[model samples]
Target chain A: MDYVLTTNALCKNYRHFKALNGFSMHVPKGAIYGFVGKNGAGKTTLIRLICGLQEPTAGDYTLYGINNTDKKIKDSRRRIGAVVETPSIYLNMTAEENLKEQYRILGLPSFADIPELLKLVGLEDTGRKKAKNFSLGMRQRLGIAIALCGDPDFLVLDEPINGLDPQGIIEVRELILKLNRQKQITVLISSHILDELSRLATHYGFIDKGRLVKEISARDLENACRKCIRLEVSDMKVFTRVMDSLRLEYHVLSDTQADIFTKETITRLVLSLAKEGCEVLSLTERDESLESYYVSLIGGTEHE
Target chain B: MNKLLSANFTRLKKDVFLKLCIIFMFAIGALLPVLDYHVMITYEFPRYIDESFFSYTSFMVILFSAFCSLFIGTEYSDGTIRNKLIVGHKRMDIYLSNLTACIIAGVIMCIAYLIPYLLTGIPLLGFFIVDNISTIWIFLGCNLVLLIALAAIFTLVSMLNQNKALSAVICILGLFVLLMLGAMIEDGLNQPEYFEDYAYMDPETKELVIEPSTANPYYIRGTQRQIYEFLSDFLPGSQIIRLSAMDAPSPEILAMYSGIIAVATTSLGIFFFGKEDIK
Candidate 1:
């Protein structure tokens, strides 16, 4: 598999606090990798480490095959564009002016692409309006626009939609998808909004307490959260016997509750259970959601 | 680096505070000469015209502080410094670029004041009023060096801090404190070495009576005087006051001190800034 970014036991500490502990993740090329972690779960810390804003305390990471400690890692970073936490921008500068500053910083050949960049991020009409006056969504888009200035192949956005309204969230999502598909840019977006992330992420890395609990593909997550039927039966022993005889795959949740994964007609299932002297009190058709899957992986109370 | 410098200058052109500061410098330049002309006409006082030309240096210290602090402070508050690093520009390059731009701003402001002062002063109060013809030239050179030093100090203060308002306060307050210290030291250095005692004939006899002579405690003597004098030349504030007075100021020594300050502060600023963690 071709990966644009990968980490091996990446660790970072702030004095006595461990921000990132043995965090290892992989972002495949052209994949919208969602980094799922609660607040203070080292999502921003990992972003900072990779973006070269802060150095790792121990372990290391590779960007496009260059190790973090190598002097040439700076060259590797040339391929990355990041909007960490809040967008890094000059509030005094207008949208176009901000991008021009970024262009100058990148030593681009000309300002020829500034307009196109603004257009790409849907800020083409924000003429002479300073970034300070821009709405939260517009500022976020401008931040994304600035990041896209150097045409980086990999974009790392930390909490890209933290404070955006629903519309703003949708716009950012579509922009990310467009960038990944049309521009062929690999995106590593860390967001805690699991449902929203489910719509876009091709892969996921679930982190808890600075450790990656699981790394799963979207298809695999869907398969893991496949459709199942939850049943509350009168007798557990009879329910198991009936399910065994029927050869239906299921998981026992409690003495009286069980989830059946195999598909069968509702009439047929009730009839089969009745023959085994099992009375179904309640039955529910259920499909596990991403939130439950994440909870299951991390295995704890809500941290959000 | 050239790109960084160019971009900084481009930004500086649009900086409102710097524009206001330049205008302020010019206003002072035009006003100070007229004030000197008034003092000369009203009291026939010996108005030092050459000294009046460089009166801008005294105010440039605080003006430079405000300009340098707020200008660099924006980078921290806005988080634009990370952008430069993200684009692969060296930290040293960014720091030096900012320092250079501020120095240029200081120069422009100084000239903005100098031009108006000379334009008004020479016609009203006459030129070359001082005995030494080269004092004005040396004073101008010293003022430039002092500006460099002041720029260095303010740059260090501003770059070390991430809060814009706090940085400005520190820079401004730092200039004021240095000014007070410089004035105190100059006052100490100006003390007399000895007290003179006079003798007069007594009314009872045809004889002279000698009064008691005492040592001047305020007089800075020996190594202490040397230290105070060296300090007067070393401190930017002291240099400002000294240059304003034009008290046989040595252009070479002032330039050397300013060079030391510029190099020292810039090196330290770059080192700390390179190690700083950008949010």
Candidate 2:
């Protein structure tokens, strides 16, 4: 697995409060890695540390295989674009002007791509209007546009759709998906909006109390949270044999309990189990959402 | 670093506050000379071009204080400083680029004042009346260095403090405080050593009596006076006041002091700014 960003025992402390305590995670080369945690769970702190906005108190991180302490890490950093906490854009400048300014900062040879970049974020028509006049959504999009000016392979956004309306959230979500799928840009987006994040992330890292509790691929998480029929059979040996014979996927939980992951008819299955002398004691349907999985992973109150 | 500097200069060119400051400086430069010319013609009094030539120093101090504050403050207020860092520009480069842009702006403002000052003053009041041409050159050189030092000090204040409004208030108020302190020190240094003795008819009794000379109470002498002299030459505020009056006893030393202040403040600002945790 090629990782674009990797942190090892990364720690950040503000006076007495430890923002990131031995935190560690790996963002693969082409994944929309959703960083999930409650408010003040070191999401922004980690973003700041990786963005070079703040230095870690202990441990280190690597960008594109370059260690944080390496001077060449700056060269590595040029490959990344990030909007930390808020969209870092000049409010007095128009969207086009903001992108031009970023191009100048990046020492680009020309402004030829300014229009295309603006259009990429859906801000191409904001001609002459300063960013101060832009709506919250427009400004967020402009921030993304500015971040894209460098044509970076890695993009980091901190709460990108934090204060947007539903329409705005949809626009940003579609943009992220487009950036990841079409451009193949690796995105590390930190947001507390689990439902929105679940829509875009190919992978997830659940953070709690400054430590990453789990990092799982979206496919694996989906499987873990998949809908299935819970069953308590009279005999696990007979149930496994019947399930295998019927070509049904099942996970054995105990000597008498299992979860059948198929849509086969229950009456026929019961009759077959009866024929095999394996009686069904209990049956119920179970479906777990990403939000519930997050809750269970972090062991916090619901809706946190 | 070059890229950051290019970006800063591009921003500086479009800065409305800076354009206003430049216009105000040119207006002051062009008007003060005309006013002095009006007085010379109306009152039949002699006025030298040097009188108002260095006057731009005082205005530069105030304008640069305000300009550097708001300019750098806008970065923090708008959060654009993060763009530079996120793009992998070194903190040292960011600080230096800002300082360079500000110093150039300060120089441009000075030139904006000088163009009119020279155009009007040379034709009306004539060239410098000082004994040595080098004195004029020294003052001019030291004044330019003084502007650089002023930019450095204001940049330090603005860069270290993230809040734009607060840094502007501090820079403006800080200038006034330094000026007041400089004026007080200059006043102490200007006191005469002693009062002359004289004989006069007493108002109460019609008798003439001779009195001996007594030491001037306000006189600052010895080491205290030396410290005061060094300060008048060292501090940017005092240097501005002295240069405006064309009373710099050691222009080279003043320029050196300005150089030291410029280097010191910039070093301190960059060091602290590097350690600052940007949000």
Task: Pick the lDDT winner.
Answer: 2
Q: After superposition, how far is residue A66 of candidate 2 from its true place, in Å?
A: 1.3
Q: Give me the runs in candidate 2 sitting further than 4 Å from their true place.
A: A245-247, A253-257, A263-271, A279-284, A302-304, B198-212
- For every candidate in turn, the CA RMSD to the true structure comes to 4.5, 1.9
Pairs of colliding residues, candidate 2 = none
Task: Report how far residue A2 has shifted in candidate 2, in Å.
Answer: 0.7
Residue-wise lDDT of candidate 2 within A1-304, one digit each (tens)?
8999999999999999999999999999999999999998999999999999999999999999999999999998899999887789888899988998999999999999998898899988889999999999999999998889879999999999999999999999999999999999999999989999999999999998899999999998987788989999889999999999999998888888898888889898999999999999999987888888989888857534
lDDT on C-alpha atoms for all candidate structures: 0.87, 0.92
- How well does candidate 2 score on lDDT at residue A284? 91
| Candidate 1 lDDT over residue span B184-259, tens digit each | 9989998776777878899899889997676888898889988998998888878888787676446679778988
- CAPRI rating of model 2: high
Give residue A254's error in model 2 in angstroms. Answer: 5.7
lDDT of 2 by residue, B25-75 (tens): 999988888899999999999999988888888767888899999999999
